[model samples]
Structure formats: structure tokens, C-alpha cells
Target: MTIDTTKKIESLIITDQEICTLAMDVIESIRQDFNNVYYKFLGGELKVLWSNQNKFNAKASSSGDLKSPPDHSVTLYYATAIRIYRDGEDLYDFVSSRLNKYSDLFEKLNLGEPSCLFKDLEKEHFVKNFFFSGLTYLFGHEIGHLVQEHSYIRRFFCDSDRNLNASGEASEIEEIEEIEASASSKQLTRRQSLIWHVTELAADHEAITWCLFELVRQAQEEESIKFSQDDWHRLKENTLIFSCAASCVHFRFNGVKAVYPDEFPIGTHPHPMLRIEKNVFQIISGLEFFSTALGINSSKAEISKYINKGVISANIFWIEKYFDKNDLDSGLLMLGGVINNENTKKYMGLIVNEWEIIRECVESIKRYKPFNAGNQDLGLMFFDENFKKEFTK
Candidate 1:
């Protein structure tokens, strides 16, 4: 199992010398992967860039090719790269002990006692995979924003609001004033906030698609690695859950919280748990779709056995970072009480409903195609009309 750490191809310009060499390598891997992914799904290309602003942030928007059939930029800031590197080193081989049911599956993740390598190199590889997968989640999220054309839609409505507010109707100027209105930014109205939540969740939905695909690539990187299709299916399900769980923990580390939040997140972002559950739904739904298409048998319970592992691992990392070992019991008990529940299902419905509400805006203005279809998109889950219909029904 040799990794070509020195392997290089044309990728993002590395301006952040503060980012560790290993971390940059991971970013390069992602850049190469995205080159194929974007073309396959979006029928377009993107320019990847690195920004060293010393902030743990990333963004997507129109690039210099903002002409017809424009290309976009997905920039990863230095602070975020540094954090990804450090977290990979810090959380290699981290998961809850409550996963004996699929212990073998995890071992495939290089998560067990090192049989060959001394001093925990297997665990190191496991964390490296985790970090890279988490990073794919982040990078794919920004791509989600681009593919979905969220910024264009936002600007359209924002401009429309400005015009409407200027030409006040029915003496609404004073009323709009008292309502704490501001067409200048995102603080204009409740509906604006709701739109924010919906778009962010949609971006997350797109992110998981890329994240799962990248995991599959990483698993098969070694020529000797193989699995029975059944074993491989379970591996995809379990590892995607764990990888996304790690990313969600990282999300929480970035100040996103929602251990037991309201049915709807009160901010622009969905609750961290809600986002995690949404990701799980994508995994199970995707597996179900694959099973149906491939004529295989996969049960909900079978595919779901490893669901709690991510929560357990998240609790361990969160408690250790934010609390202490003493709170581990309570944290594990409390961290994931809402996942896979009826409440989450209903809340997910709301997200779909909101997306469908803006589906026309997305369809009318999207700059690219994705496994293109008129009514459904398996590649970008939430964009599929049929899935939205059945899902919300």
C-alpha cells in the first residue's frame, strides 16, 4: 500500500507556504480529482486557487472567465488548509467503541491495530483519508454553490428587493422600515433567511455527491484492493458516514452548533446535526437507488447499522476538544439524539420544499449540466424533481 506522496500534476497554485507540505499534497489530489468530476458532471471546468488570508474560509464565484459559458473559482484559504492538516494529524483513527457490529468494515479503513507497520502508520493513513475526505466535503460544497447558481439567484432577488423598496407601494416604506428591512444585504426579510438555509443545504447536498465519489476513488487507488460488490457497498456506506461525520465535527469546530436545535436552524446555515442527517439521507437514498438500478437487495436496517458510529466519533472529538473525557458519556448520549428520527425527516422535507420552490430559478439560470435530466438528477440529489416529489410526498 504505497502512496505516491511525491506525485504531482498541474493543480492549484500554492501560495500558502504556511500550509504543511502533506496538506498541500492532499489539496493537489483533490484538484486533480475535481478536474475529472466537474467535467463529467457539470460539462465544464473550474479554476482552483489558494488564498492565504489567514482565515479558515472558502468561497465560490464567477472567475475571470465570467463571459458566456463562464468558468468559476473555488478558493481554499490558508487557515482552512492549516486546520485540515492539523486535524488529520490530531484525529487519525478516531471513532467510538460502539461499532463492533462493523468492526471489520472499519478495519478496511485502516482503523485497527497495526499488524504490519509499527508506531501506528495504519492509523495515520486512516486519518489522512479522513482529512482528505473531509476536505473533499468542503471543496465540493463550494462547487455546489457554483453549480446551483446560488449567487446569481441571490443577486436577482436582492436587486428586485431594492427596486421594490425604492418604489414603495401602499405606504409600505414606513412599514418596511419598522420591520428592520435592508435591501442592501442579506438582512432584508425572513424569506431571505429561509432562502439562505435552503441554498446552503442544497450546496451540502451537492458536496456529499462529490465526497462519496472521491472516497470510492481513494479506496480503489491501490491496484491490489478489491472487494465483493456486497462488501464494497457496505464499505461505501459506512466509510461515507464516518467521513462525513468527521467533516460535520469539523463544521462544529468552526462554530456551527445544533446539538438539539429547533426544527429549522435560526441562521443562514442548517443545524450541524441537521446537515449531518441530511448527508446520511443522501447516503442511504443513494445506496437504495444503486440497489434498484443494479437489481440487488439492500435493506434499510442493513445499510443503517453503522449510522451511530459517526455520531459516536463526533462526540468523542467534540467532547475532547470542547469539554473533557469526563463528559464523554453525557456527550455521546446527547450529541446525536435527533438523527434518523421522524423530526429529521419532516425537517428534511422542508428543505426539499424550499429547493423546489426555487428549482425554476436554478433551472433557468444554471450555467452547466449535471448528469443532465429534465425531471431528475441522481448526481445532484436535491435537483431531481422526481426525488423531490417522492421525498416530500
Candidate 2:
């Protein structure tokens, strides 16, 4: 099979006139949100190209149609987004009508009232949340990939035979143990285990952070006034979205519970819930500490007087109780390293250097149009080298 190596990859954004403006607004919002947090713990550059009213009438695959998925981009076509799978220069394939499937599932979940006016748009919010979660999951998965590069135990798991050898019936445990003696040694350290756990937690955090931003954007938009109890009910009904979204909500709720366990019952994904509780609480609590570290005090409102900037004042106290300066510094170092890594660009499949791409995107945003029925652009803020220091300092 001959591959069209000469074919140029293009960015496409698809949407009908009704939703196109809103979708574009979302695209821009997503871009700004991602860019703003580019140096944070869960931040990574995602080159999701926005294509509207895409003309490509691609067929849906049963389960595994795409041979090789592309590393860099996503295609959002008129509510139906398809991720492109690239197999070298030989093949490129995509999914068709993603919104249709999500919408169908949304209906299946019976998430809203029949009288819902922005019913279709509500589904978009849910779908957007899914994307946010997926992106976070991908980052964690990518961290897994990176860890496997140097992980001795992970290398064993990477081999199917090793996995089979590790798992056996209790009756066969003795035999497996005997066989294990003969097997090459590959042990896991506590640190390694913690690293793996943190990786997953980081991914979850990333997804939650993205979702929070999305929800905030919606809340700020007048068009999203249509979002109602029915919409919340609908969101809670979808299995996939509900699971991911619930996990985050559960996490926060758990925080409140931890402070007052007599109030709420336990739930699923408790580890994630606790972690979220800790992370969020800690970050908020530690804000004062961080502010102290940077030698900035807003208590007198002096900082605000100089320049009214968004100072995350709510969660500082919680983070301070659980976090040390070392922990903050370590996380910041890891985040900064990843943000500055030249290899991330390779993983993203960028042609013109990432720095250049970012430069261009920043320039383009000057004229960015808001996605429909909203003025989300009001929140758009650009950051460069100076702003990159926000989290680090």
C-alpha cells in the first residue's frame, strides 16, 4: 500500500451556523485555558486543530478502524469530532459524527426535560467535559509511557509473558513462586509505586482542572443561562461523563467530608477522591505559603492596588497544612522540565518548532472570535516568559 507522504496536514473546524460560533468560542477558550496553565503541574501543549463544517464524510469504524493515531491534533467537525490516526505517510483515517453519538447517549441517559431549550447545546458541554477528561487521561498515559522508558518493573509489565507469569491461581502460587526464582529479577520500589500513583492522580487533576475551566466559561456565558437542573440531571445520567465528572465532584465532596465525616457517606474512586481533596485543599491552603515564598502579601490589598490580577486566594490554607516547600519545588521542577522539553514537540508531531507555533497562535488570538451566543474572549489572557513564572515563583 502506497502512502501519500506528500499530503499536507491541515487544521479543520466544523460546525453548523447555529453552533459554529459557540464551538469556535469553545476552541478559543480551550486554547487560552491551556496556554495559561502551560507551566503548571498538569499542563502540556495539545495541538487540537479546530475545523468547522468539515466536508470530509468519513465512515465510522466498528472498534479499531484507525491503524495509527496521530500524536499532535484533533478534528472537531460540526459537533461530530474525529481523531485522526496517522500511519506514517501511508494512511490517515478518522471517525465521523461524534456529536451524534454523544447526543444519542445523552438522550439515552435521559439527562434533561423535554422542555429543555438548549438541549443540544447542553450535550456539547458534556462532550466538552469528556474531551477534558480524555486529555487528562492521555497525559497520565503519556507519563506512564515515559516512566516505562526507565522503569524496571514496568518493563516487565510491558512484556505480556511477564504479566502472565506474575498472575496465577493460589494453588499455582507456589509453583509460580518457584518459577519466579528462575525469572529475571525486576522489583518495584516504594518510590516507583508512588510515582505511578501520582502519575494517575496528575492526569485526573489535569482533567478536572480543564473541566473546571470549561464550567467556569459556561457559567460566565449568557447563552449558558439555558443550562439548568435538567442539564445537571442529564449530565449525572451519562455513564462515561458522569463517572469522570462525578469523580472530581466526589473528590471535592470528600474534602468537605474529611473535615466533617459525619455528614456524607463514602463513594467510588475513593483514592482519586481523597487525592483531589488533598491536592485542591493543599493548593488553596498553601496559597498563603506560596505568597509568602514569593514575598507577596495581599492581606492589605496592596498587590491588587498595583495590578488587579487573579490571585487564587481560596485554597491556600488547605495546601499549606499538607505541603512542604520541597514538595512544591519538586512538582514545579517536573512541570517546568516537561514544559521546556524539546521532545514534547516531537511527541506532538509539530513541524515548525513548538516555540514558533506558540508564537503564531498567540498572535492569531488577537483576532480570535468567540464561540457562539457568548463573549468568552473577555477572559482570554496571553502569557509569555514572564507569565510562565506564575506557578514557579
Candidate 3:
């Protein structure tokens, strides 16, 4: 069914409490699995809220008295979720239409009907999984920023400018300075820009790690589900696809591109395409890392083959076709030359090293029995209180 694109986004005021609930559940599950003391730092403080902003975006920030421990806040704009859903639905329709057109060719070639390949595209299960995984990646990345103390680090570096008050929003002058820093022709020094880029990569790594872990945990916990080896492979492939979709949504909505250093300096976040490439690489590297770490005897070569054939090839084709048909500026496709295989391999090595550093820090924290996951429910009760009602009007 075609989604109505003509409706004013502000009038579509629905909030998916389920998405917020699932995000909390996923974070709780990860905390349960680790049971490390460090995880508790964010347990009570991290909150997810819905905002009625007309734009497609989300922001993570800290709140509470500066003297006391601050609470980390994540606001998922309603318009952002609507945009993601609409785009995803459109992509599904496009895929389904293409499959129908190719069904006759497939039959002549003795390749089963193309419809069977995407039978689940329109199903509720697929829609839920797609949004679940995508939202998890987005929310989890923000949580990563908090848990990694990026804000605290930023405060330390820009202490004079970032004196936090009780409300947690930046001071007016600080906000202006931030805007100026981002928009200025005089970019942050290379060292400062690299720090920002590394922090972003670190957050991406954490997001991918947690999302993959949660997906596997959920699959294993399913009482009625029996997954064979092939099923596990398919599950991993789907996780990657949803993760890519999440990145693409952010890239498209935010108008992120790979700006050449000569043309424009780096910003607080790495180029959007760089972020996508890293996420794709991290999934593969993470699979390899976890498989070996868990003694699963899974071959990296086999996983790479699966990714190349199943996820990477299919997504590239579909995304390119989608952008071409819509006439959207194709930053994603143009990123190929910038993030080629050699660069990806080098970045993979860097991620492994960075992960090792992060792992050591996490391991240093004493382990504890799992916290009461039920306590997280208290954080979800403020959704209505926190919703940005002004935009809806």
C-alpha cells in the first residue's frame, strides 16, 4: 500500500511508543548481558523521549544540575520516525514492483519466482524488525556517546565555553560559538577534528556491537524459534541490512556528504558516507571478532562471502536505483571512490585497535550481577511530559 506523502507531517502526530519501549528493552538487555559496574552509570540517567519537531532528526544531550550527576537524554523527533517509515515503505514498494517485472524472466531461467524472494517485504514482521534494528542503532550510538563520556571530554576541552547549568542545554554563547565553529572557514585544527572523528567512530562501533548482541540474544531467547546455521546467517544479513538502512536514513535526512578536505574542513561528525562505510565494515569485523572470541569456529572468509553476495551487493543495487529514480543527490553512490577497499581495510585495522582500547576500559570496571531491568521502566514514563508539543500546533 502506498503511504500518503501529501499529508502535512505535523498532522501525523502519532508516536510509536513501541519503538521507544523496544529501545529501552534492547539497552536493558545489553546491560543485563554485561553486568559491569560502568554500565550502571548510564542506567538511571539515559532517557528516551519523543519530540514533535518538524525536522527529521534526533539529538543526545545531558541534563540535571551541573554539580550533581547529569542525566543523558535522547530525543527522537516524531517527524524523523515518520520519514524513516515512509522511506522504508517506499523502498519496499520499489523492490516489490521490480520483482514483479522480473518474475517472467526468472521463470524462464528456472530461477524460482522473484515474488518469493521478497514475500516478507510487506509483512509486519519485516517492518518491525527493520525499524527495531534501525532505531536501536541510532539510539545505541547516542548512548555510546554518553557511556564513553564524550560530553564530559568536550567540557574539559572547552571548559570556559561549556559551563553546564541545571537545565543541561548549552549556554546561549556556547551554542553560538558551536555554530560559528562549525560554519567558519577557519576549521578546527587537524588534531581537534581527528578527535571528533574518532569519537564518532567509537560511538558507531559501540552502536553496532550492542545492536548485533541484542539481535542474537533475542533470537536465542525465542522459545518457539529454531534457527539452523543458515538461519543464523540470514539473521546476521538482515541485521546488517537494517543497520545500513538506518545509516542511509540519517545520511539522507541530514544531507550528509563526503566533503573533500580541500573543499571543506571536517566537522564534529565524520562524513556521512564514511560513517556508512565504517558501519558496514564494523559489522563484518564484529562478526569475526565475536565468532573467534566465542570459539564459534566461523570462518571470516565465509562471512565475507555472505556479506558481499547477500547484503552489500543487494543494498548497493537497490540504493543506487532508488536514488537515481528519485533524482536525489547521490552522495552514497559517489562515496565509492572515497572509501574504496584499501581505505576500508585500513579503517578496519584502526577500528580493531580502537575497540581494544575501549574493551580494556570496560573490563577494568568490576562486574556485578545484572541490575534490575525493571527499573528502566521508570525512565519511559516521561514521554508525554517531554514531547515537543509546539511543533504539532
Candidate 4:
């Protein structure tokens, strides 16, 4: 609902072909980046499902003497929607209503501010927005579940109804298990429930990264007259961008604050000041401004100034407990080196070094306990590493 003068509505809208093309390109990149276990861990099997302006409609028909129910899959439903029917009418009805409500919200919100989920389907980037910004990001969350291996551990912790959904409505123990495996990998263990929250965060971070890419790409083609003119700055501030990925990031940031009171007394996720100070804002800002690989003439001095003034957004307690300070500090330094550029790709070599350091940091963090390969922790590690590497280097 906020107004943004920076974006042109036309620039934000991509044609159906453009959307599919970009989405497929993104997906292909993902496939290349992830393979086998990593792919499975990252919810790879789900792939990218594209929908045209052809609205999903449920129809009733009689195949034989008996009338068949609606074809739910074709309808606007989650990948989890199929199980709703078996759980009984209540569950089915509940999901149906929820989906409809969200659909309505999508319409009402008109998140056409490029990369927002509510972008109209008739537009081009809508599919890309849904896939890269919305779905892929969320799928990464599901990958978090896999990383936790919730299912394997579920046997030891779960009660008798291992098949039951969280609502305890139906006996989809296997279906639920498979869905969990396909999306989140496995059900969460009692001790690992919090991991689910992290997965959501991880997904958010991934989604944000991709969204940044999309936003940057969109900005470059602005002069072409093919894109929508939705104000990018306004869109950035709308908060809906975080509704999925950022939402999880916020949740875990809060939870980690509560649970690890001593270690993360302030919080797990970076605080607003720190987040901005650390150029999380600028990274996003950079992503917002640098719409093309050709690069844009933008000022990052304002961003650098902010980060330099803030308290170091690092918690030594947790860093010592879960990460080696030497590695962690080195990682940050490497990232800073890359993102430190004034505007041009001046720090390309440093960016490459940042990537190496970040990779090591990520592997180290994943090997640690509590987070022991949990979703958000790894996500945080990756986010810190990649952004720092890409931007500054």
C-alpha cells in the first residue's frame, strides 16, 4: 500500500514467456548449484511448477454412475493439499478456505511491486516472482526439515501416531512422511521442532538472495519500456517481501533470542541497526539498485557509513560456542573486502576470496551442535557468507 516513486509499474511486469524463461533459467541454475543429496536436501524434486493466467477451477463431473469430486490438484492448492480430503471434511474445508483467503489477499494486495508474491498472474514476472521469490525460497525452508532429518529422528521421539498430521486429523503417517521428505525432508523431532523455524528462515534468506537478483535484473532493462514502473524503493519497504522468507528469519531471530538468553541475549538474527549497519540493508539496497550485471551508477558510501558506525553485530558467546572466532572473523573480513567497493566491480578478486572463506565458514557452522546442520543456522552462515562475498568483493 505504500507509494514508491522509484519503480515504474511497466518495468516490473514481465510477459508470460519472460516469466517462464527466467524461472526456468533460475531453476536450471539451482539444479547446477545443487545435486543429489544437496538437491534432495533443498527440496529439489518439487521442481518449478508454472501456471498460466488460466485460473485454477475445480469442476464436478460424473465419470461413471457415481459423480466424482473436484480435481483438487488443478485447483489453487498447496503441495500438501491432497491429504486434506482424507483427514475428513473439516480439514479439507479448512485448507480450501485458507487457500481462497490467500488468493483474495494476493488480489487485494496487488504486490505487483516486482518480486512481491501478489503480482498479477497476467503479468510476466509473476511466475518468476512466485518461483524465485515465493516458492523456491519456501522450498529452501522445507530443505531445512531435510537437513534436520526430522523423520529419521521422529521414530525415537514421536508418539504412536507417527502418520498423523500436526492437526491430528487424519492417518497420513506415510503421506505426511513423504511430503515432509519431499519438501522439508522429514518430520521434526521433539528436540528439533525449533529446527522447522530455522528452515523457514533459511528459505527466506535464499528467497531474498534470489529476489535481489530479480530486482537487479529488472532495473537494468528499465529503459526498454517493456517493464512495469513499480517503485522499487517503495516495494523494498513494503515488508511483504519478507512475508515468507523474511518472516521465518524474523521468527528465528526472535526465538534464538528467547532460548539462548545468555548466548544471544540481543537476538540470533542481526538486529535492525546491525542488519543495516552490516549492510544487510545495503546488500538489499545494492540488489535493489543494481538491477543488471552491466551494473548501475549507484552510491554505496551512505551504506558503508552506516555499517562503520554501528556496534559490531557479532555475539562472541555464540560465535565461540558454535563457531571458531578465527574462522568467523576471517569470514566477515573477506565479505567486507568484497562488498567494500564504492560502486564498480572493483573487488572482484576479493569477492572470490570471500566466497572461499564463506564456504569454509558454512561447512564449519553446519558441523556444530544444536545447529548441527539445522536449516537457519546454515542459512545464516550462507547468507552472511554469500552477500558479504558478492557485494563487497
Top TM-score hit: 1
Q: Give the TM-score of candidate 2.
A: 0.25
lDDT order, best first, reads 1, 3, 4, 2
- State every prediction's TM-score relative to the real structure: 0.67, 0.25, 0.61, 0.31
Question: Candidates' lDDT values, in order?
Answer: 0.52, 0.28, 0.47, 0.31
Q: Report how far residue 340 has shifted in candidate 3, in Å.
A: 3.6
lDDT of 4 by residue, 299-356 (tens): 4553333222111211222233344546334323222432343422332333233334
Global local distance difference test of model 3: 0.47
Error of 4 at 300 (Å): 5.1
Tens-digit lDDT track of model 1 for 145-250: 7777665555454434432221243221111110111112223355555666677777777776655544444444355444346545544544644454445444
Report the lDDT tens digits of candidate 3 across residue range 203-236.
6666666666555554342453554455465556
- The C-alpha RMSD in Å for every predicted model, in order, reads 8.8, 20.6, 11.9, 17.8
Give the top-scoring candidate (lDDT).
Answer: 1
* Preferred candidate (TM-score higher): 2 or 4: 4
Ten contiguous residues with the weakest lDDT in model 2: 86-95
Model 2, 57-118: lDDT tens digits are: 11101111112221122333443223211100001010112223223323433332212222
Candidate 1 structure lDDT: 0.52
Identify the runs in model 1 with alpha carbons over 4 angstroms from their true place. Answer: 1-19, 23-45, 63-67, 93-121, 157-188, 217-246, 253-258, 263-265, 291-298, 323-336, 339-350, 372-375, 381-393
Give me the overall lDDT of model 4.
Answer: 0.31
